[model samples]
Target: MARRRWWELPPAVRGAVEERTGPVRCAEPVATGAVSELVAVLHTATGAHFCKGIRSSNPLAWMHRNEARLNPYLPGVAPRLRWVVERGGWLLLGFERVAGRHPDLAPGSADLARVAGVLSGLASAPAPAVDVRPAAVRWAGWVDPEVVDGDTLAHTDVTARNFLVHAAGVAVVDWSAPCRGAAWIDTALMVVRLVRAGHSPERAEAWTGSVSAWASAPAGALDAFAVARAGLLRERHRGSGAPHLGELADAAEAWMWHRLPL
Candidate 1:
């Protein structure tokens, strides 16, 4: 399928969308993953809302729906699910846009702790009977026992770009990669991403440890899973054509091998 340009959206469709969503002043595409397109829409009355467009045939539609269903349950952890429109084999989900700096650009121990607490709450929540897969399972042999057994809800994509620090608190966005697994899996991904971005190894470790401590599991096991899962994620993203991803993955792999003991 040819990549659909944001400007190419039909006036009728755009108008209908705006009417349903409120008054959209500006719409700009925000690139994140390969399967879906995210548009950050600035509404004159509603402020900002993110419109996530997904193909009807995409296997991850279940994940998106699950996220929508789970958002209300997680009051402050995620953006509010505003509206969902299905048209022409596409699912456009509108979410309240989180306003603030990306966690990576403005790293702080307080922010990390707040995010950790939010994740922990989500993980401790009762698991849904959704068919979402475990992220650790995707990497096969690199799987960590803690992640495999915890079976908590995991936001597989916990990168800084996915986290939005707002006045209400930090809200995590982009739920297309939600997983039904351990909270440690999410923590590991976040720590690894931060470490890859030049955060001190000691700081990353400490943050991970603190998050794990809040989780209902042994810290050592969670740490092990975080290390191994970080390695696997880095290895997979290392081949990505995106220069930043490749660079981050390479750095994460090095940190996994050097800073983390086998």
Candidate 2:
């Protein structure tokens, strides 16, 4: 998607946002995220709000709505969704601007400890009764569909980019594709991301020591999931040809091989 500045939006769309926020004072574009036609922090009479918007007719538009619907279920773990506005063929979302920086996931970074604590909190949360896709369905082709079932809501995409390390703790963002699955699944997913960030597979798995769900997870299920995740990453990389996806796919395969018996 082409980058869109706040002023570039149609007046009707800007007016819709102003209705909730009063006059907009300034807008600072956020450059980190891959999605969103427009990602900016809007300063207004209401203070600062992180706003993301996309054309309403886009195929990925449902992701915006999914994030809005799931935000209520995630109180402290994520930024609160303040408002949603649809006008001039665009859908805009406003979120409370959390003051923080992206976490460092390297082995000795202090931020890693905070990330572990936050991931543990998420693992313990029961799945919200919402219309979300199940992990079993998402991994059906690559693993035994039944192996991924559980009552916990898993933030399957636990990359370093998705977490904000603040004074209070860590906040996970981007709830667009969360799924219902085993409580240990997120810690498992993070393991690959950690490996991608320079942790050896052994140390990455060791970091999950504080996440109780990881300790109790069935060894067979963990093995199955690693293989399935690696397979999926490989397929996605082949299709997208994104360098980062290829790197991540290699990391996932390395983690999967590390789990196998010699």
Candidate 3:
């Protein structure tokens, strides 16, 4: 089946949700990735809600299901899940919109600290045994093996864009890549992305330390995981037209070659 636009949800589904939540005032494309489409805000009588659209063709349905199942267990990590709708070949999940901007827009020691804390909290939560091997295969071209194995619950994609800063606190979103692995995997991914975005090494290191302290992970593993993750990012984005890919690849290569020697 062809992909449907976010505005093209079945009338029945829209009606069903509206009856409970009120009308959807507006929806804007918030984030788009290889597996799923994310919408910023779907206004209802209660308030604005974030909607994540998952394509049936994508194999990350398990991840979404895991997210729905694990949401209750994770505190202050993600927005509250309002509803999950499966229509035709697509799945639409509605969540309370986390009020805040991406962390990149507002960088600070406090913001970084909050992000680290959230990530750690997520890693520490109990989750069912999930087969992360397939994820390793799918993301193998994009991430290092060292960061993709073991029993730790790792949020593989931990870029600044995944965080939402609100008046109350920060909330992390996008669980499509949740995998069982070492905690450092998530930290490594975040540190690499931050460095690629031009954050100083010291700041990135500090953020990594904060995340480790919050998550209770070993500090020595941070540098190795970061190097491996940087390489993975470089390999994945090497030929992409996205301007940031080149910079990220360069930073990853430098960090891997010089600092981590990986």
Number of the top lDDT candidate: 2
Residue clash pairs of candidate 3: 152-181
Instruction: Kindly give the stretch of ten consecutive residues in candidate 3 with the minimal lDDT sum.
Output: 126-135
Displacement of residue 228 (Cα, Å) in model 2 is: 0.7
lDDT of 1: 0.64
List the global CA lDDT of all models. 0.64, 0.90, 0.64
Per residue, candidate 3 scores C-alpha lDDT tens digits across 1-262 of 2344557776876776566568877766665444555455677667887776665557767767766766654456667888887766666777887878787523464566677777777666644454443435645655555535556666677667778888887788876656666645666667667677667655665666655432455444555555555766566686565667777777666556545553
Q: Model 1: clashing residue pairs?
A: 152-181
Worst 10 residues of 2 by lDDT: 69-78
Give per-residue CA lDDT, model 2, range 47-100, as digits (tens): 999999999999999989898888898747789999999999999999998889
- CA shift at 239, candidate 2, in angstroms? 1.3
> Of models 1 and 3, which has the larger TM-score?
1
Clash tally, candidates in order:
1, 0, 1
lDDT of 1 by residue, 48-73 (tens): 77777766677767666766666665
